[model samples]
Target: MTEVTVLGAGIAGLAAALALRDRGVSVEIVEQAERLTEVGAGLQIAPNGTRVLRALGIDPPGPESRAVHLIDGPTGRSLIRMPLGPGFHLVHRADLIEALAARLGDIPLHLGRPVAGVSDGGRRLDFSNGQTRAVRRLIGADGARGASRHFVAPDHAARWTGQVAWRALVPVAGWPAEAQVHVGPGRHLVLYPLRDGRLLNVVAVEERAEWVAEGWSQEDDPQALRDAFANYAGPVREVLSRVERVHLWGLMDHGAVPAWRRGACTLIGDAAHPTLPFLAQGANLALEDAWTLAAAGDPAAWEAARRGRVTRALATAQANARNYHLTGMRRALGHGALRAVGAVAPRAMLRRYDWLYGHDVTV
Candidate 1:
């Protein structure tokens, strides 16, 4: 029997365990946290990501909404709005986390057991409580700051992308059903409905310097986020005003790394690559990584099969960040052009994202 240990019980970790278990591999999951939970706000899972979930035999049950187009926030005009197809779904972070955790059943999950170190000798994992264990294979789904990254690749550090994001979830009783992104100068705001029209998810991005706190729980002044978009028109001000609680965090990007695996240990999710939210593919990419890693029959082939796809996904995410944070004259001209085209042909604008939403990971 092949025994595998996965670090971190996040979406990627759980998905890896599930995928591996389905393939007849004995799996043990070790999580540093005392319990499984999700922080931050809502996350949008596009078609590519949804296909991975179905492949894992995990179907997320909830209300479904379509993102028709992206719009210029200041002018209240569309950039692009295309049909998202059947696989696109949205859910709260906690909801998705709970769903993944529930699927693990009785699989040994050691919580409050933070990994202190990982050694290459038969994949030794040292826990915070002075305990140590050795396994045949180790998977690092541990996230951006996990000890696995250091053991696998010591040269990599998460780079800040000079931006911070604030997120919140409000009631959807009065919100639009279509997912909308409001783009502005040096900032952008996105809104969509979740949980069968019960909640409206809000995510606002702003360009910044000197603020480098990562993760989703950092406190940020709603007024500060509002001030960044003070010039924007439409429903942005109303949404910002209604926001009583906000979660803020710096956007960090990890440039492509050499390899996600080292010897008997391999990396997954944020542990392998951290991406900006511009493309909303962070979680989707993580899920895809889990599926690919688990589906690979031989551990030796892991790097070869995953490296190219992961690199391309990271690059696409970086390009999205640059496109979303357009500034000065470029921002204005881009908005003007989008508004002009949007007014004449909205469906054509929506069709531009077919490559993104139309992607099917099962292939």
Candidate 2:
């Protein structure tokens, strides 16, 4: 009988644990947090990612966004509109965690157990609490800086992207059942209604000259968020006015790790590659990784199936960061091109990204 140990009980970690358990493999998951107390926010579960969750018999409950619109910050006009794919939806971060937690069944979970280090060639996981565990196989979903990274990819480091992001949920009465990206010079604002349209999730990103801290849980003043985006459009300004709480973090890109496995241990999700939030595929890719890794059971094979696709996602996301912050000629060109797509061949344009929203990784 073989057993697998998973580090981190995050979206990725929990998904991996469930996938492995479904395959009749004994599995355990450990998390540093005493419990799943995720922040209040929203996440986009594109059809590609939601399919993975559904196949696992866990359906994430949330509101279905009708489409994603690229809105001009100054004109308040939509540059483009792409319908959310089948089953594509905006779910509260807390709601998603709760859904996944309910389906864990009998799998062993160790909370408040921080992994200290991994030693003896991926055979031992030393926890900070003076306890150690060994498993025939392991999945490194702890994070980019976790102990398991040493066994999988030792030389990789996260490079800050000279950008900072602010996240907040504001109470709003009536917002379109869609996600909107308000683009402007050097900054962009993404808004989507979550939790039955009771709260609007706002993620505002801007490029900065200096590097900020890297963690995601940093708190920032609401006034600071308002001051940073004071020049945004009317709707964005109104939404920001309703925001009383916010979380801020530096956008750091941990370029894909070239080495993700050693012995029976392998890395997944943020541990293997941490992409900036521009593409909104962090959770999606993590979900895909959970299914693909357990099904393949070979590190090289897993990479072969996933690395190219994720690299493409990372590139697309990076390109968004550039396109969203364009100023003069480039910005105009981008706006014209998108408008043309939206008018001339909307579905075709959507199909152009069939590789993304249409991708079904569970099969």
Candidate 3:
């Protein structure tokens, strides 16, 4: 019998499996998809997440990010540029998944098994295929909608945030190694180069009364994305014009789940806290959870140690969503303040996130 069974083979699951196995614990993975594949675009791994990857013997695979440039979308004016420190990387999701999976040699990975629910105090996993399996322990890394999350923290409903985002990858060359946020009224777009500057990842978010379903696979017309950002100037417009395919999803605020542990089951990543894209700490927090959970030796204790940091990160990300979409006087004041700071004390702005980017969970 495997010592621990992890649900869902995404970043969280795979990372947990590797971390445990490397610590001399027997671990297995059960994934719904028949094949282990990451279906998304680029993600930023801040220093905190990079520390975990380095500890696991996996160097982050991508170009090192030099800075984050916040620009005014309508006028194409640069507002501020915050230089990043070492270990910040812009990596393709698929590439990171592959790296994690490759390190899980000889570990049991049961794919194509869709879990319907959990029973018998989180020990029995009921499958959608009319099969059931009993495991000694469980790690719920399946994601927000996975059975593990529902079992660990039940009765929590995610309310729509009245915002929808379109994600696409456009081919590009010679782009600088920096992440750019184009801020506009009630909307914002983030762009960064990925896969060795071969593809530029575009994530454009807009406030909408029209409700859209929450999930990454939902396809949206490229024209709709273009229309949403029609007023954006400079390279943002040029980039949107080239988007032939895009995925749309409604941003839902799951708010921190009431519990990260129950019985023999525990949650990590989106299964515990589903964050907005504003802070770019989703994957980073997941990486930290994987490492700390494996190293701590007790699930409940691990959750306690992680709760504060995770909660702060979630709140920061939510605040950023609101700040990025300011309008009218607020927009002008915010932009002017940022410009002032950038001109006089640029490094201070980057230093504001020292607690986040400097955290070393591996130590």
Best by TM-score: 3
Alpha-carbon runs more than 4 Å astray in model 1: 340-356
Model 1 residue 162 CA deviation in Å: 1.1
For all candidates, the clash counts are 4, 0, 0
Off by over 4 Å in 2: none
List model 3 lDDT by residue over 320-350, tens digit each.
9989989999999999999999998877888
For model 3, the superposed segments whose C-alpha errors exceed 4 Å read none
TM-score of 1: 0.91
Question: How much does candidate 3 score in TM-score?
Answer: 0.99
lDDT value, residue 233 of candidate 3: 92
Which is the winner by TM-score between candidate 2 and candidate 3?
Answer: 3
Candidate 2 structure, TM-score to reference: 0.96
How many clashing pairs does model 3 include? 0
274 Cα displacement, candidate 3 (Å): 0.9
Root-mean-square deviation per candidate: 2.3, 1.5, 0.8
Predictions in order: lDDT: 0.78, 0.85, 0.92
10 residues in a row with least lDDT, candidate 3? 32-41
